[model samples]
Target: MNKVFLLSLYEEAVRVSKPKHCLPQYFNAFSKNDRVCVLGVGKAAADMAVEAHNYFGSNAYGLVVTRYGYENTESTGNIEVRLAAHPVPDENSVTGANALLAAASSVEPSESVIFLISGGGSSLACAPPSTVSLEQKLSLHKFLLRSGASIEEMNTVRKHVSVIKGGRLAAASKGQNTSLVISDVVGDDPAFIASGLTVQDTTTPQDAIAILDKYGFDNASPLRGYLANAPLLPKVKGDYKLVANAQSAIDAAVEMAKASGFSTRVISYTEKGEAQEVAKRHAQIALECKQQGKPILLFSGGELTVTLGDSKGEGGPNQEYLLALTKYLDGEPGICALAADTDGVDGSKDVAGGFIDESTLRNAKRKKIDVNAMLAEHNSFGFFESLESHIKVGPTRTNVNDFRVIYVS
Candidate 1:
């Protein structure tokens, strides 16, 4: 019953953000005679393109770039879908960016362009400047992922290094632009989503340099030279709408918890920090809730970071959070919790996340699994897989960052 209830909350959180649920009402942005060009980028790109294609029918034609496995198999009228690597950009990412730039440039001044932007767009539509090779860009991504920098900070650096990011895409377009965004970052700022693809950029190259310095990159790094010569981005105009976000998912989960007869408290809709440290604090809250002896549910959203200094692990932030949480929980009864990315993939693993309850620690001990060692090595996926406790929901098709729920009864 606990598992069922927790999973239900996750499903409800994801359902509200689907393009079908949140996009149609915005269709008024297009008109009968307008030539429509749809551009989409991110894990939700294909799905959002399908929605746009359905609304505009044969009149809509453009390109969409998404993660390799996240393409929507459903028939989309005339939009072409391209697959690319994420978190780490590949050659295909460059191709996707060039294609999108061409599409945006070809739009007539009288036509209207729709930009379907979402999380993961940063990597899915990468276009590094000629001074920097794809290998260097890939290395920078690997460093940032392990550096514990926040999404905004990482994208600040990304914007300065890329050709298409930082409003360059918007600058190339002749059509009036309208961006429909699914926000995965806390604060949901348009300037940071997909590194402000269709919006104006306010960040300077020095900002990217500062982020690099903060992350321990030496002054001698070639990126510093590249950023030093980075051109200023032109001011651009676009109507940016946040169609879905972490807050919406949290609101839906709160409603479901009330319907389930549990009093609920929202810890935050913008939770952020290191995974283990956040888990420790959350564990304390869960323990306090249990002591009160009343049915209660706790909810939070926002992405967490895992700084991998030396350990090479098969897990994401959500899985790491759950693993750390299980240690702090220490098999406490009447409490169960789950943490997962709303996008369905947590870290680079196929698994969504992990789950834990009163019996988790005990079961680990019985199975002779060393929880402490696993956590230290950042191998949460391995630990959960050994116990068959990880959640696997392939490509939810939308990303709103991390969703966490804790229930005490």
Candidate 2:
């Protein structure tokens, strides 16, 4: 496997998430009314707002909440950009959450309400439950981050705790509401994306409680009471559109590889599960494709979760997935692969993610790094650093979950 070409596939996936290419189609379709409110929440919200401002002129005005480094609202004239915490809710997210409810308060039956929802919005844009404090929410969010809880599980709990999630924002709009969503989930399920802030949620508060328990996320703190007395949401159905998804990243990677004269095939955009387990499956698939004389490129994009079991590790799902695959592969064949998050931030760390091939195992071993021990610690970043394979892109201002490319030829 050629590591140089494999890394290019990762770059191409990220390049597609930029504003100009993947965003304009959705932004252009949205016609802003003079009396419209264009509020948003997610990693891409601020960037969406900026484009909305440019497309609709000064008429579109509203607020958007994003992680600290993910905002792209530098020159938005009419729109307000709010930075908040993500993967964990802090006071800022509480403020942003309150702002979300506040932003949706002034809706009228005749006025157009344009809601921009995207991945990472659940934690980035939040309003805590009446019985819960921001600190409590933050603590719980931190636990979930390291708990290996799936996005569905994490969001299920979030929907009940949030005053604006689980269709509450749509309920807030009350009148004419239209939501433009950029999904970072498999199949682009709006309910799971951003906890369905602007869409209706069929999952009950009981479901939320069940998920928290199912994952053994039961922290005997302020959470028990908070979950017991979760928020009440109103039923609402609003216009929704899926503008971006994991498929977008996969398609982009395929094109980029093809442009460079390499055969590429999209394996799946619906890969999900624990990072290591999925990696093992993906590794086997790559080997099979190589042996069957169908040597080409394989791509996949989806969100994966890492369940931490009392381990101190500096890693995210993508990096962890790679570590698991490379360790098992152990230079078994000539397979090179690159995996990363499209948002350019894997987990809460700097740099998008990392890549590997046959030589990766040899390099890590020569560097005296225990690959299996690192995986056990969930420290894929450190292992990759030893191999100098960590890919860093800071914040791309857009997220469509993870992008993985397996080059067979």
For model 2 the local lDDT of residue 53 reads 78
lDDT score, candidate 1: 0.90
lDDT, candidate 1, 1-409, per-residue tens: 3887899899999999989898888987578456699998998999998898878888889999999889897867899999999889999999999999999999999888999999999999999999899988988998998888999999999988898998999888999889999999898988888888988878899989989989897677688889998898879987888999999998998998888777999998998899999999999998987887867888999989988887888799999999999999899988899888999999878988989999999999999999999988999989899989988889999999999999888
Please state the error at residue 222 of candidate 2 in Å: 4.0
Per-prediction CA RMSD (Å): 1.1, 2.0
Best by lDDT: 1
| Tens-digit lDDT string for candidate 2 (1-409) | 5767777777666666665566667755555546678888998888888877777778887888888887673576678898987777677877887877877887777777888878888888778767777777777777777777878878888788778888888787755888888888777888889988987778877787777787676657777766776656678877888777778777877887788787777767888899999899888887788778777888888888888788878878899999999977768666777888888888768868898878888888788888889988888888887788987877888888898887776
How many clashes in each structure?
A: 0, 4
Return the TM-score for each candidate structure.
0.98, 0.94
